[model samples]
Target: MRTLTVFALMAVVLGGSGRAAEVVVPADMSCRTEGFGYADTNRHDSSKLSVRASSNGNKSWIKFDQLGDYDLSKLRAATLTVFLHEGKSGSQQCDVSAVNDDVTENIKWVDHPNQENPAEEIYALTWNNAPGNLTSDMGLLDAAKTTYIDTITFTDGVEGQGFEVEVLDILLADTDGIVQFVLHNSPNLLNFATHDNPTEAKQPYLTLRFAPEGADHPVPEDGAEVDTTLAQLAWTNPEPNTPGEPIYCDVYLGADPNRLLMDKVEVGPDVSGVAINTDNFPNFGLLANKVTYYWVVDCYDTDKGLIKGEFWSFYTNDNLPPEVDAGADQVVWLGMGEDPNQVTTTLSGVTSDDGLPGPYTVLWTQEVNDAPAVVIVNADQDVATVTFSERGVYEFTLTADDGDKQTSDTVQVIVGDSPCDASHMSTGEPYHPADANQDCIVDLADFVLLLAEDWLACTDTLTQCGMLLPM
Candidate 1:
């Protein structure tokens, strides 16, 4: 278990209160307790901790302090990074519980008379179907003492050694500046690097991300292209408003970036997102394509008059050329024919375009040469069948033209008298002895056919000699 105490580090703050901020702190003290009811065994200064649940196994505790610098109420996200000392093949479950009282560096293995057992496990790890309960002598306590916080599951089979856990709600539940945690009852033995580890980088640490004071984290991201049909504006507001003093936002939007205040919309604080269509704002109508729109959200709280947000912009989708996929190259085997060897195969072509501007048209054209002419059915349709009359390669192109743009794709069709010949013509690969079934590619399929048909059989010497020519 890793506990991030903010007691000593006051210079770890990254940003101001107007924007998101990040704070990182490391565990201040950690110790492992023997599972047996011993009175005097403690490993406080070890560089590694062994956490498990057997009768003789050990449970660990981590303590962190100095979190009095920042207000915990504004914590948006919290994460804990722990490193495994040694790699393991499978996953294990380690139950993390919040300690009601702080544990000192000289804490013993046995529970004292007034030693308050850890409250109901805060995080019940799900591995090997282990129940969510504290099974250690020093960790056992009334299950109803605390409410269930969360369950965190992690896989131990990682290429590297570091693993992180989301502890936002877990940390928010602890109001006290000092944070303490108990690690016990893991399905498998877990060896974790301690705060006193030789490598500072491997020591467990915690990161906290705080939301800005005003509305932020706009949707669609700034400068992103959005669809006009489902256009909507959204943002995040971390500060909660009081019941009697509800918050209101004055949303200003316009196509001209310099004069964005031309249109103003007033919405309640409960509405985090508003649809940008004609139904909501008849004056704004459907947004024009390829046009950039600028907007800003000014939230008004009774406590703090009006807090203006940063101006954000996004471009509407533009009319794009039809995306064409003239299916894969094909191979066809001609049937027995005397005059002209011929076969027909479907050339499946597909096209997609933004229905802006107008409808689109499709055309199929073949490359004319001295070879026998190929006939295409419904040449204007996307998916059309083509007939090959000669044992040669034929090429056809599918072109899609929208009113604004046009695009094309080509596919080749190979015709031959036999399947193997058709495959060889399509691949252009030289035949090999290992291609037992006459296919151009020699893979495990050939091995399976060879093993199934020609395992161990001997021919008669007389027949073999008679069939051979005089040498």
Candidate 2:
């Protein structure tokens, strides 16, 4: 028959304690002997094996091949199973011992070396009946011969009952990879299915449980470049041989690869993915336009503990928009035949683009309003000129663009009534047709101004009086 020993590596400890793994080894060789030194008589198929202890000491020996690769020092827990087929008598106490002799499948019952002085007693248990006498050592065997690890008690003679024994420490101390065990009941006769049984499913086997392995399959693909500031991180859970165990993941993120600045998210064991954005972390703040970020996912189980993953990184895209800052508002007064250059307001502001190369494009646009304003823009330049035709308020906007993105800012202009209007003075003044000086008196001072500037040919009323009105 073929020998089977399966080794599976589980969790890997990143920065903390080491991880654990599991191994399964099935019995490769087994034989049973009758009382009075009888050799192999029953050539049973691979369906069942038997053991008994009466006047002459009925015993069975089982051994596994090639198991030395497992590091006994790293072992946490282990179990050995013996599948019971049937029993002849009532409750029975069984003695389990480790075989120190070199044995193989070819050996017969009479050829077994340990038949005279059986190997060291490692474990003992009761089997085949309810509330069996577990305290009894049958007086036929001595206790001080070897160390005993643990014991098991059987409640019934039911078929297919697995009598399990813990042998973690015993296996660790064993130098040779060969696993040979001897089973004999001192009080009653017990029968069990062995590796020779035709029903292979009932064969004896051993299982070792340990910590989990490292996480895998990270999103964003390690060192990929992303366009958005918000990123979703994900990874696969470490699979376990013992099913139904809950697994939790802790996500770490930061601009620095070594030190994670983002708040750690305690995700429930049910979820494998998590999202991070500017809203979630205010102090660490939003992800800047063209910055690189590092992240990792640490996986854990309540029983197995923590296993951290390797560090990964991704960069953000750099085609960001420019920022615009329109200069402050301005106010102006009206005058007759006024040259726009004399009262023109400089419409200017600052702009910046953190994206790529060189100077960005700048534009100034005049917004249409109810106010009579003659707006002119030097669209090519960062600063421009704007003039008002009449007394009213005007609004202008400045926009900056960096090919991929654009932004704008607004500024207001207030144009008040001409300051030379004597008729509209706040003070209660009597208006005169020749009030050129607007002194509320309309006297000879106004007349002298009009006469010196050609009063006779002046057709316009305000111009004839030497009074200038806003153009």
**Distance (Å) between predicted and true CA of 283, model 1?**
18
lDDT of each: 0.65, 0.59
Report the C-alpha displacement of residue 390, candidate 1, in angstroms: 50
lDDT of 2: 0.59
| Cα deviation of 298, candidate 2, in Å | 1.8
Q: Over 4 Å off in model 2, which ranges?
A: 1-20, 37-46, 87-90, 100-147, 211-471
* lDDT: worst 10-residue window of model 2: 124-133
Q: How close to the true structure is residue 274 of candidate 2, measured as C-alpha lDDT?
A: 80
Query: lDDT by residue for model 1 over 1-471, one digit each (tens)?
Result: 343312212236764334457778887755565544432443443566667666566666555666656687889788766666565666566666655422222222222223323353222111111122243443342253322333234564442266566677667766656665556656667777677777676676777887666678888687887767646888875465565667677776777654344477788955677778666555555787777888777777787767666667888867778989889998778863443466778989998888767899998889776446767898899999977666888888999998767899999888887778887888888789888777667998889887867565546565563576456
Q: List the residue pairs that clash in candidate 1.
A: 6-66, 7-65, 7-66
Cα-based lDDT at residue 234, candidate 1: 88
lDDT of 2 by residue, 111-134 (tens): 223332324332111121101112
Whole-structure CA lDDT of model 1? 0.65
